[model samples]
Target: MEPLELVPGRYIGEGQPCFVIAEIGQNHQGDMELAKTLRQAKECGADCVKLQMSSLPHKFNKQALSRPYNSEHAWGETYGDHKKHLEFSRDQLHELQEYATQHDIPLTASAMDIPSLYVLHELNVPFIKVGSGDIHNLPLLRTAAACSKPLVVSTGMSDIAWVSQVYEELTIQDPPTPLVFLQCTSAYPSPPEQTHLRVLDTYAQMFPHAHIGYSGHELGIHVTIAAVARGARVVERHLTLNRTWKGSDHSCSLEPHDLRELIKAIRSVEAALGSPLKAFQPSEEACFMKLGKTLVAARPIRAGQMLEEDDLVAKVAEPRGIPAQRLGSLVGGYLNRDVEQDESIMEADVL
Candidate 1:
């Protein structure tokens, strides 16, 4: 499959470094301090910092808005009010976009409604991020695909059929949209058991044309690292300043320190996952020198004696002679010279 370039110069594929996303979704907690968070994400080695963009009225109906938000994480009495506190105005988003451009920090956002997606598309975001909740929103998917920007879609609380529909819709575009499907579980602090990381493999097989990725809500950074090892070219993990912060996503988010370590760990694993073509590596030469075995003289033998199995033993030798694996060929051969006990059986010593 041809590698897709998600950003201008960076490519996403099997050979490319894992694209680490620091999803600062609503964790800014209506602070309007996106610049600070963006800077922190850069310091944490994030390839990109993702924000959440939404037109609340367009996304939620009156009935849904009227629902009481009673959790301790709630900033307002009702769900709508709570979301309003986190929602950024168009001007605010533009300001954040400008800041990201100035600082050279790559930034993108999740679009929850058509209007929001249009706004982001107008801004020429690196890509449009479709949150998991919108997996079945065919209209939104079509609108996003038309935007012509590559997409990073999270698939959580969704079945294979739902995913297939999304894939089919995107693939039929005039020029097929470049896509990355992030395997995710909807739980806020998704447990390891529910992560279903193996689904990444499923996505790879189902959508060979699209890049496969992971968006983890699981606790700790290990699972995120594991995702990269399992062929996820993109990894999205929530990012927050503190886990104790008053937000539903804080507990699942990685703080600056954790984000830094997660990036480090992913890169380390990428380096360690080297080429699939198996052959001798320079790094393994020392091990081969010390532990490689060769057929050796099991006991003292006089010149002109025929070599036999009883006279050979495999052992480590300074100068490698006939390898232990080829010992059968020498069994019927006659020796031309005497050999000391414990000496490697050389090819030149046999007829």
Candidate 2:
């Protein structure tokens, strides 16, 4: 979410610095072992790390659990067990908050249901994030907005109107409103053709008061970095230690190498963007010496002879001479010295 008033506000959407979120999501794979291992995700260049808050029963049907939505990395045989394994208790979340705070990383998450939202509220999380699945959950959206916490809303599968409605609803609060919309395409490793990056611009125009962002599902670093270059202020991408880790998000998540590369690229893009000034730079000052023209003697000319175009030629290696552009005014001036052929001519050598 790009709303900066939520404590870490300076890093959200446009003109403000980009806030990079490393989404750990369910890659914790229901093992607290993995979550603790990721306390340093921030050191890897993320401003925040995100988790998913969900209840096992609410998230999966009983039948689905028995059948077990089989994924290679899941710990349990069924979907319920898998979610149960992934679920972190309130105490666990509190520990996570402490770890994040201690490390100077913002720990945030997406609320998938009312109970999850209640848990987050109880935890007094810094903000609320709505995922692609909940974009149309008006009641959930209202509940989230009512909390008056900063909101990060993702638009994965919705049309413009659907997103517009969400924006309008969130704004029932006030101006300089505290919400940001992430342009997302809801697919596991979403396709490039489907990534309508142009929506970031449209969203910015439609809700100029809100921060516009990009939540990436692609399998690499290029798209997220490109989004920053195009003016997106918030970038949230799935992240994992290993892409091969089995989970819904693993296939699309950035491994440490890729995530690091993206962070470097985004920062380089910002440095390269610089201020829009068109003036010459320090490194460019050298070019002028090689390319600029300076007046030079075309051939030997006696001191009494008035200078003539044929007597001088413009050439590089200026040697502190008058520039060639001023040669016209010096045409009839007297020669102060007897100049040799092909010698660089100085203004002091003429009247």
Candidate 3:
């Protein structure tokens, strides 16, 4: 219920590497062998790897289990039965936790129900994510918040009011930990227009106390990169071995190579965001001084002549000249000597 204390080298907000999360979400497809492929997520340079935990039997409508809901898809007939094929047992999840820790990648999960929440809480995770489907499930959110773990929630399908409601419900009791909000759209393979990266700017003001993130379903590394540029402190991207792989999320998920590209781009964006403070940038100072305008003589003028409108012009290089605006003051004053055309006019040239 308190802000999680971040270690010195690991700054999560502001100018840190946009913390990358590869949401493995059910892409494990219930095969522990396939789940083992998640080891590659860390190899792709993810800051954390996430899973979605749901006791399908407990959480889904049992009616969907009886009838085989025929579909063009290759899965089970009923929705519930289809989910059963995707479910992983407690042991498989435990092995995943161990594997992630061994690789030095923090593993977390989304808890869609109480049992799912219990499973993740028991895993001793550093954070818990609330997937877009459960954004309206305040009870689950309250439970996740009460556990006092750092939380990340996706706001893809949610509106501004709903976003505010979720934040208020979760933190009103005891200010939750470093809760991060991810702008997400529930659509699989979400389109670019739905991303609305500007919301990141809005949330920055709305939730100044927490980290703002982007949970992207878009097709490229550019949106992910732009999110970090827009001030996302965290980025959640789905990961899969191949887009052609037969899974509901495979289409939107980043393959290992794409994931590598994403990390590269986001890091570059964070490096580019730099400091909000702006003065003459170091690499630019010399160029700025050289190319910056300084006052110059507009026309030839002789000694003892009074300055006039034709006497000055703005030009680049050696800003040491009597910059153009000073032309006003230079005017009506006696010229100490002749100033040449195209030459930098100096204050000393006039009395």
- Rank by lDDT, highest first: 1, 2, 3
Q: Model 3, 73: alpha-carbon shift in Å?
A: 4.5
Q: Highest TM-score, which number?
A: 1
* After superposition, candidate 1 runs with Cα above 4 Å error: 318-320, 347-350
Residue-wise C-alpha lDDT for candidate 2, range 1-351, written one tens digit per residue:
333754454445445567888889888877777886456577678778888898656755778768855667667877677677788987888898888888887787899988889899888888789999999998888898887788899998899998888888888665534887899999998998899899988998898667888999987788888899888888999878777776778889887778888888999887787787787788876887778788888889888898778887888854757788888987888787888887777767776
lDDT of 1 by residue, 135-189 (tens): 9898999999888889999999899998998899899765679999999999999
Superposition error at 339 for model 1 (Å): 1.2
- TM-score on alpha carbons, each prediction: 0.94, 0.83, 0.85
**lDDT string, candidate 3, 101-200, tens digits:** 7877777788878898898788777788888888888888888888877788888667999999887776666445458889887788888887799998
Clashes of 2: 4
| Candidate 2's TM-score | 0.83
What candidate 3 gets wrong by more than 4 Å, as runs, is: 1-9, 69-78, 285-294, 304-306, 316-335, 346-351
Q: Which of the two candidates, 1 or 3, achieves a greater TM-score against the reference?
A: 1
What is the full ranking by TM-score, best candidate first?
A: 1, 3, 2
Query: What are the RMSD figures for all models against the true structure?
Result: 1.8, 3.9, 3.2
lDDT of each: 0.88, 0.81, 0.79
Give the winner by lDDT: 1
lDDT of 1 at 148: 82
Residue 19, model 2: lDDT of: 81
